[model samples]
Each structure stands twice: as C-alpha cells, then as structure tokens.
Target: MLIQTLAAAATTAAPQNKFGFVEALQAGGFIAYATVSILGIMSFGSFYILFTKFFEQQKIMRQGRDVGTSFWKAPSLRDGANKMDKNSAWRQLVDDGLAAEDQHGKMTDSMEAHDWLHGSLARSEASINARLAGGLPFLATVGATSPFIGLFGTVVGIYRALIAIGLAGSASIDKVAGPVGEALIMTALGLLVAVPAVLAYNWLQARNKRIAENLNGFSTDILANINSKGAVRPAAIAPAKSAAPAAAAPIKK
Candidate 1:
C-alpha cells in the first residue's frame, strides 16, 4: 500500500512540458509556419545589417583619427590625400578635391575655383553618406512590420483556439490553455524581434549622423585651406605687409 502511494505521488509530481514552440508549430498550420519563417528571415537580416554597419562605422572612426593626424599634417593637399588609407572616405574626398582643381576649366571657365572645389567635395561627402546609410532601410522595415506579422499570427492562433473550444464543447483549462499560450508566444516573439531591430536602427542612425557631421566639418576645413593657400602650391603663401615705410622722416629734406 505504501509502495503504491509512493508510485502515485511520483507520477503526480512529474513535470509536464506542455505545448511549446514545436507543438505550436505542429498545430498552427501553414499560416503560422509562414509567419514564423518570415520573422526568422527578418531577424537574420536585421542582425546582419547591424553587425556589418557596426564594423563599417568602426573602420570609419579609426580612419577619422588617421585623417586628423596624417592627412592634415602633410605638406600639400595632394600629399595629404595620398597619406590617407587608399580606399577610405577621407581619401576619396581628397581625391575629388584635387580632381576638381585639376579639372576646373572643363565644366566652364566662368565658375570660380572655390565654387568648383566646394561642389566636388560636397558631392563626395554625399556619396559617402549614402553608402553609410545603406541597409538602414531594411532595419527600419523589419522594426515597423514585425509586430504586425506577430499580431497576425496571434489572431490566427486565437481563432484556432476558438475552434478547439467549439470542438471540445467546453472551455476548460486544457481546452483554453494551449491555443492562448501559443497566441501569447507569437505576440512575445514579435516584440522580441521588433525591439532589437528598432534599437539597432536608431543606434546606427545616430552614429551615421555623427559621422556625417564630422565629414562636413572636414570638408569645410579642406575648402578653407584651399581658399587660403591654393590647393596645388600651399607652401608659397606669404603674409601681407603694411604699406607704411619705416623710418622715413628727415631723409627727404
């Protein structure tokens, strides 16, 4: 009798892992499966963009230090440009500025050299910004749409639960729990996917904005230097002297 009681107690105490993700998938039909698959794809894409853009931004930041030290200190604009990393945005801007100086007459001889160089640098900065902004749209899309996708799954799950209650002819715990749990899981999954994507998108965009500001400031400095010393022969600039002659008093008498 004691052995029987212990056996019964052990059986009752055994934990039941109920209708989890796999079970939901099994019972959720094609719509549920498709929704999950789409969310999975979106998650993968968001993470990929986040990581790639992160590394890319870090590279640009490191290049910023290089530009401040090596590029600015070089003797000539062309030499400064050459000192930069070959494929970096800073190098590209410098090359564009030099090219503008070289090709000043090709567009129209009437345009001032300052304006031509400014326009070229502007264009280069815009190109770099556009490149940095790539993949951001995908992250935005995922963040915006993932919740709706999850809601769709939840609605479907609830609908299935209602059908299940109808078939069982009772709204008991067993009848209500499975479908409700599945629906809640869908909602949770959707939020899980969306929150990170939104956070990552915002973070990346903020970083991009900072980088763009730096680029614009750098362009402005380059333009100022060009105006002051001329892009080609920066070393030849000389300070202007006052027109007044020194110690000219009585010699004329």
Candidate 2:
C-alpha cells in the first residue's frame, strides 16, 4: 500500500517539474510579458551603441596616424600644409605656423607662436572630443536605467504570483515557483545588459584621452620645427658699430 501511494504522488509531481519561467510567461501574466519587453529593448540599444562607438574610435585613430606622419614629412608648413585634408588637425597647426611666420617675419617669443597655434589646436581638440564622446550618452542611459526596468518587471512578476496564490486558494510550489522564477529572470537580464555598457564606456573614454595626448605631442613638435627655421633670435648680437648710440649722438656738449 505504501509503494502504490508513493508512485501515485510521483506521477502527479511530473507535470509541475515541467513548468518553467518560459512556460509561466506563456500563461498570460502581465509581469512576465513586460519584463521580456524591457529586456529586449535594453539589450538591443546597448549592442547598437557598442558597435557604433567601436567604429568611430577606430576611424579617429587611423586618421590620427595619417595626420601625424604627414605633418612631419612636409618640407615647409605651406608645402605640406596643403597636402592635409581639412580634418587633419596636425596639418592645420603646421599651416598656422607658416601663416604666423609670413605675417610676423619671425616668432620672437614662444608665447606668440603658441597663440598662433592655439586656434588650430583648440579646434582639433574640440572635434576629437566630440567624436570620442559619441554613443556614450546611450551607454550611460542603459547603465542607469536597465536595472530599474528589470526591477519593475521583477516586482510585477512577484505581485502576479502572489495574486495567483490568492485566487487559487493555495500556497504551494506548484502554483508559486514558476512566476517567482520568471520575475528573477528580469533582474539577471538587466545586469547582463548593464555590465558591458559600463565597461565599454570606460574603455573608450580612456582610449580617446590617450589619443588627445598624442595629438598634443604632435602639435608641440610641429611648432618646434617652425621655430627652428627662422623664428629663433640669434644668441649673439654684433656689438654696436662703435660707441653706444648715446655716445655717437652729436657732440652738442
């Protein structure tokens, strides 16, 4: 008699074992449906930003390399400056140096040369920063909001499970497990979407900063070359042809 009863209980438990969070979702609970929807959108948005940012940063680095090499090779600012595309900041700085030389004859002070170089450098810095910052807003949005979206889904799932228990007039694993399990899936999904976005954002930001430093170094080199050509004042001045100008003044006394 004991064996027969145990066998009957096992047969009844088999159907409950087959139930899962997916099966619970199919059972028409608002909580499960909403959780799935939010997770889908968050995941898609995160991936889109990741790939887009990757391409943008890669392109900028390539352009930087090209610009760096060309800036050094030009015979004079005017000659090589024209070879660079407008997007190349290093080339623009070289052009600025040439223009300053043409206007001022020579750079008497380092401060004056830097002032002439400032326009091109500032413009390049702004543009590079703008490109690097692309897609970061979306990454930030996902990181900040994905968890809340998932929590919203979880809460709904739990509430639905509680209601199901009340309506069925039972508090048993068969009725409660599926819904609770479904709710927790949302939290997991939220973390899944958020972790990568946060990490990618930090990584990209660091790379861009390094690029900025490289560009800054290049700018200094370009200016130094321009100064070398004719910008520096000679170290020694020939002594005034005879006595001081005052002594050479008419001998009124």
lDDT of 2 by residue, 86-120 (tens): 75645555565566657654556555755665555
User: Each model's TM-score, in the order given?
Assistant: 0.84, 0.68
In candidate 2, how many Å is residue 126 off? 1.8
Please report the candidate that would top lDDT against the real structure: 1
- lDDT by residue for model 1 (127-235), tens: 9999999999999999999999999999988998899899999888888777788798889889899999999999999999999998998887777777777443323
Cα error, residue 35 of model 2, in Å, equals 3.7
Off by over 4 Å in 1: 1-15, 230-253
Least lDDT summed over 10 consecutive residues: which range in candidate 2? 230-239
RMSD of each: 5.2, 10.8
